[model samples]
Target: MRISVKLASICLMLVLLLTITTPAFAATTNPVLSVTGTTVAPVASVTPTTATAPLMPGDTGTVVVTLTNTLKSPGTGNTTVITESHQNVYPPTAGSGITTTRQTQTSSSDGSSGACELKFVNLLSEGPIHVQNAAYTDVGYLGLGDSAQFQFTIKVDDSAADGKYYLPLKVKTDNDECYVNQVVPVVIDSTQPRLVLNDAPSKLGTSRGNIIIDVVNYRSSGINSASVIPEGAEFTFKPRAEYTVGSIGAGEMYTVTFETSSKNATYTGNPSFVLKYKNGDNWHQTAPLVVGMEPKTDAAAAGNGGGDNTLLILGGVILVVLVLIGGVYLFMRSQRSKK
Candidate 1:
């Protein structure tokens, strides 16, 4: 009986020892993975820096995005983050105006057994704007106090008008479920100068004369280095071939006078008026304008000179007949006095 009691006591002691040592071994081998007191709260943000300025048609630009993780400890494995963007219509470089949509992903963490993530950002344009590459970019991995940057290539639709576009972006993390949304503005500066003829003379004489022509700027922007030139072979100008107009503003007008004459002998028609101006760094010309013209002609040579010569000859003949009659009368008077 004593032997049986001894064996039972030994078994009980062994069981207790195993229980205490097993936990200690486990504590040493595998560290606690979960954050003790503070949870991993990651923070993220996005910036559309390119939107501050304007983009012209066929212009290529970039939009930047930044992400940061504020986690206290590394808890999980790799976290997936996605960034997505969409626009109402594609750029003009594309065949036609179509919808643009894109997505990208990244894995970010706090390092040392932590996870990292990236998310999609939605962007839209009021005008026709498109994304060339994927709308979103992958940052790969991000650690604690670590920041990641992504760049997106965007194109302004070639057919987009001069205007502003509002694009909103959404950022999210797959692991933490954290999200942020931001809106950025993009301006389009691809407006061409519009020139129109205003307050122009209805008629211009073919003789060497000066006439005023008003060049109107009908566009929303200003026209610089403007000039007007007559575009007809039948007309010539004095002082200069082209008249200088300088600059004109939207809804404003500038007038210039050109000394012009007809190159032809006799002609009556309009003279073409062309507007040349500078827009941005390029020069442009407008459609030809036709003005009324009455060319000089020799009316006297046509018939009036011959009619006057005939009248003069008839008068000379009548005067000579009167002179002869007077002479004969005087002779008869003298002869009678002598008798």
Candidate 2:
């Protein structure tokens, strides 16, 4: 009975020893192996920047495009399970003991793993828009949360109408792994105010005379900084350089007068007038209007000549009457003396 009790105590101690040492052996024998999973694809956001909106036709400017990688680091977790079995004999006794142990350890990491490679970037020109620069190639890699900027020079054709236009943007990666095709919108504004010369002086006298001109705005929009510039080869005009008319509303009419005199008595050259105004932020001038100016020198000279001739004729008649009356008085005196 004493032997049985001692054996039982010895077995209990062996079991406790095995339990403590088995965990330490398993920890050293097994190591956590990290297995990387598939990486998430990168998605880029594109933003375009322009200097001005509603650009006028025949304008040149730059377009800057920013590409941002919006993808984040991938999350990963790894788990390792270790199973160990051991057999132990305490005192070479008939009864032996067997022990089994299991250990589990997990390791994880949430970090950046992937990047975006841009092989080519291009901005294509469409109708009435031309690209002035070459396409970009081998732009390089962009990691998560990374961004890049590309600048392009562009020009709008002079014949482009007033409307909205789209420019195609092409982005590509190696072996066509990632491709993106998008469009950027641009506005074209080519509207201009229309000005017409309604009326102008048809004749000018030799002396200082008034040159009246009627200006009419034909457009529905208002025109600012309205002015008129008169040009003549044979005449000198008031406000020799420019005549400011201020502003004119839609479909409005404004009359301006200039004091002018002919340089010579006969003006054979044609006179012209130009209308200058501003639309939005651009200044425009209309084609010169050739106005006919007839000089009144011939009529004035004829009237003066006729008046001088009439005065001479009246003087001659008075002189003839005086001479006849003198002769008659002298004859009557002679008759009276003879009587």
Candidate 3:
């Protein structure tokens, strides 16, 4: 009977030890306790909603980009995936202190990967507004539950045609093959005429010279009565003050000649031509096209030379008179000495 009781006591100790250790084994074996959260792909969206345009060529402006993170549960382990997915995402999170590289936008239409890409770059001191093989500015690091608005500086190509043109914006993450191509509207000012100083004479003749003026109508509509107002006191033209040109077609060149003359011998000033043109019954005038006029005349130099010649002639007469007086005195002295 005593042996049986000892066996029972051993069994009871085994049961107590199992009760304490069983909870620990269950905690280690249960997979739910090990994994605290779930991980999924990064969910984010970038939209270029509004664009401001009608900007002049050779001018710079800004484009706004809206970024939002739509991820419900962003995973810790997938942070790298999220960040790498938005490698081209721009204007990194505040204080994240991340720097990104400038990239070019490529067109699948042509096989030239980044060569002919249209991209926006920092404006250099001297260069074309649109850099070759580059497209839009990259805004880096768009994160979950975060919204960012980024302003991108862009330049309109000087040679870009009037009317609305769209610049393609491409956003992609290196981690995935997904990319978004958003087109932004760019409008070039179509109403203004580009008045370029095509040609001019180096020197205006004393009486008259031909001032060649070119009216380049780059607008869609033609211009009428394209004229130049040569307004200055020092100069005069055939017509009182205005030189009228008939009409100029769109994208056409009209060369008008003005018979300009300088009034004074010594005139050193800019002879300005105010460009006046009419478009659809509305008159428009451009800033003065000031041409440097330095009147060329030998008359001024000849007048000074004539004064010198007069003084020389007077000197020659006095010299002749003095020689005669000396000769007479010498003859009188010779006669006195002989007597």
Candidate 4:
């Protein structure tokens, strides 16, 4: 009986000791092996970022990066604290509109030892172009069932050029980390249309002898004559009527004239004339007159010289005939008197 009592006491003592230490082991169901995180996008924000469009220049925008934990802790279950940080990855080239911003974790502490936790932050990066906001943080004090959520935002500048941009992000939990690679393309429009002149005028004048011209349309089906300058400058040829200039079909031509009084860059000789036709979106040029040139003369060439001699000779011949007739008449009169 004595031996049995001693053995019972020893068994009781051992049981009590085991129970005290066992609570700690029993408190934890499992041991946490690793930490992992993934982004949980709000149902409306499946893209993770606020917008997927290429960021506009001089514009402000936002993005959301989500992080999650992969492993659950053991024994004591997971009682862990988690934090998140953010960074920007600019385009590969310097001066690229692409840039980045680091978001400070807006919040991270929750007393609950549960499966869910989230961190929200505001991020900013300025300049024109495309860039990204990456939530990079790790699971801290991971015991059992440790997890975290990281959310951040970013902005793109309005002066950014158009092209393809790349945004790379990374996610971290405790000691483990993962990389996220994304590409965002930015497009820019900076080209202007060109306007060229098909025909140019070299002179401007009032007379027909200087320049004669045939003008035509340059770019489209027509041009506006209302833009004609120096209004009412004695136009010999009708530009609007002849060319249908307001509707000057492409490749169509019209005629105009220049007077003899026109001048060249070097000479103002009245012997020549020039016609100028300037047409353009900016209305910027003059063409040389293609008209024929001719010399001018007045009425002084007639009414003088050798014509007086011929009149005198004809008058003398008529006088001789009259004298002969008169003598015959006198002879007849004497015969009659003698008889």
Top-lDDT candidate index: 2
Candidate that scores best on TM-score? 2
CA lDDT of every candidate: 0.55, 0.64, 0.52, 0.35
Model 4 CA lDDT for position 164: 43
lDDT of 4 by residue, 66-103 (tens): 33334344224423332333333355543233434332
- Candidate 1, residues 1-339: lDDT per residue as tens digits? 756765654555454334221111111111111211111100113233322334556565555555566554654433445343333444544334444444344444332434455545444443576655554545344555566555555666667777666566555555444555655555666544433444444444446766567777766556567888776666677645787778787678776676777665554555677888764334567777766655444662446567888889998999898999998999999999999
Error of 1 at 261 (Å): 2.9
Question: For each predicted model, how many residue pairs clash, with residues at least 3 apart or on different chains?
Answer: 17, 0, 9, 44
Per-residue CA lDDT of model 3 for 5-52, tens digit only, reads 646544554543342211111111100101111111101132224323
Candidate 1 regions exceeding 4 Å error are 1-207, 263-265, 295-339
Off by over 4 Å in 4: 1-4, 7-17, 20-52, 55-115, 120-127, 130-159, 167-339
TM-score of each: 0.42, 0.50, 0.36, 0.24
Q: How good is model 3 by TM-score?
A: 0.36
State in Å the error of residue 195, model 3. 4.7
Query: Which pairs clash (backbone N, Cα, C closer than 3 Å) in model 2?
Result: none
